[model samples]
Target: MKVRDSFSLNPVGNTSKYTDFINYIDTSSVNAGLLSEVSFLEDEFPSRAQRLVRPGDILYSSVRPNLRHYYLYNDSYEHAVASTGFVLLRNNSSYNTRFAFYYLSTNEVVKYLSNIAELSQSTFPSFSSKDIGKIDLPDIDRKAQDQIVSILSAYDNLIEVNNKRIKVLEQMAENLYKEWFVRFRFPGHEKADFENGIPKGWAYRRADEVIDFNPTLKTGNQTEFTIIPMEALSTNSMVLDSGCFVRQDSISGRRSQNGDTLLAKITPCLENGKTGFVMGMPENEVLGGSTEFVVMRSKALTPHYVYCIARSYYFRQTAILSMNGADGRQRVDEDKLKSTKILQPEKTVLDHFETIVTPIFDGVYQMVQENKNLIQQRDLLLPRLMSGKLEV
Candidate 1:
């Protein structure tokens, strides 16, 4: 069906309202739950040129349309503002909102959007609202559309639930670590033999004694800045969504290597507990960082224990407090990171710990790998399910 016939396409903004401004939701606003978390939000443009996205409105991204970021708003997400660039369809009374959503999500429509978009010189090329308006849509009976949407929605529900469960499992691990390691409470707390109540020969020692410092890096040898971009930096999970290719050849300072802890040294990430053990690096001698992470090493310290502790609230608070500089992007200085005290366990205890912790990491690692597989399956099914070709 010709799109102009059944559901007319309308640009989100109106030219008549002299004072109308674009209401682009910022990332902060999205995080605040003011708009659909799935929606692509821009900053609020305060001009009469804006449009108030009502409930049931479908907002499609005008630029980089292939990112497939769009949303069909529910009543709960109504009254938020959006950019004039989003293509808003005024569906006929015969249309099902959910069906229309799935229909628009199809690769068929996306290809149309990409094909007509001016790619001569632009970001991920995209179409203007006019282009979308002029495009044809496959017309199916409304009942059929409803049935299709219900099936696809069921898949969406499963994906969402699995993602949520992954989060809960990680949180559970974190809580357990804190209760046992941080709070120093175990099952045999009351009547157990005690060394100053540190749990039977378990001694508290400074982080310095266990680890004086990491091996010094020669980050200055590079001719241009090189780094593992943040996209390659995964948070709370093992797999990263971004690629590890570097854009630069040389850097002013040294970077990390395989087996090093790729800790995000900057704020928010450091605060958010962003860290991963570097396993595969493109080169052995590339220097780069976001200036937000402090790479730490445990020469004798088990990597698992190190990683586990680094994720704790105790370590994050200590690292954040130990950080220097007045700028928002504060960092834990090399000296401080090396000098900070830590609760050290004996090698005998740690040797015992390695056995127990290895299994836990193995379990966590298995779950992470499973999550990655699940995500891949979901992503692969998304376009197929949405397009109706795979039929749910």
Candidate 2:
């Protein structure tokens, strides 16, 4: 059956004039199977904020359909307005909304939409709301659909819980770094002496003194290395996406090994805090990623310590200030980054700090790996269930 037979497209339209502070959703705010963030629209762009969205509606990106940016709206986003870039799918009496959402999120539907989009004559590939409505969907029984949704949602729910735990763990590490290093409130602060606002033995040194910036790139076509693109690095997550493997010769980006930190050096991405520590890549396997990254390895500090320092608000602010180039194409100045000052604590104190935060970061890495596995499992089961190859 056609999707239109089971769902209505954007059932509500924003026609009221008195409504203020419209909740808005854009393509970038939506991740695959997740709604990461939303923007609230005021009176500034009245015309662009006319597509009213309601609870249970699926907002699927019509433009750049291959990215598969879609989300199921809930009470949190009730009465929101989304950009026209989305094809809102509102479930009807014939199908369950959760089932419709999961079906749309399937790889099969994404591939279908992507093929339809590529066939378009427009310079930027896209499909219309009518086009979306025409796509055929399985007319599964509602009970079976409910069973499928329940099974899949269980994995997603666990992943979400792990993500929250990871966030708190990361924050705890960052906060500890701030308290000890930034605020000079280390364990022995009462007995420690200070000279000119510096700890008695601690010294201000250039970042290069402790961190190696963009070390030598390994070259060869013989080995298969994991390639991490800019999109694979989520802002502030400090975890690299499970990247694809390619022959070394095909890669033209910065090279890194496990334990190195990656920072997006380009505009917007840098501003968005695209920084992560390289973890869980096969042991001893060389990793290559976007050339726009400044790969930093710690020589004197612990890897976790370096990651926290790089992701610190002060460091990011300084890096942003040092960026130079034309608008939208600006990049961080490597020289400026190397010259940035770093606070070096006594070896014992550094050891204590590392001891305290290492397990926290280790837990974060473990959670990231678990989430990746969960996503893989869910994706693998998706097609089988959707096609009835596996009974729910």
lDDT against true structure, model 2: 0.81
lDDT tens readout by residue for model 1, 14-107: 4333333333442212210113222323443345225566667776766656545566655443335655556666666676767766666666
lDDT of 2 by residue, 1-392 (tens): 88889888867664475266777776666777666556655667546565678788888988878777888877566457887778888877668887778888887778888888888988878887888898777778879988999999999899989988988998898889999999999998999999989789999889999999988855554356668778777675776655323445455678888889999899988987788888776666677778998999998887888898889888898899999999999999989989999888888999999889888878988898888899999989988998999996
RMSD of 1: 7.8
User: lDDT winner among the candidates?
Assistant: 2
On the 0 to 100 scale, the lDDT of residue 182 in model 1 is 64
lDDT (Cα, 0-100) at 66 in candidate 1: 56
Error of 1 at 274 (Å): 3.5
Instruction: Highest TM-score: give the candidate number.
Output: 2
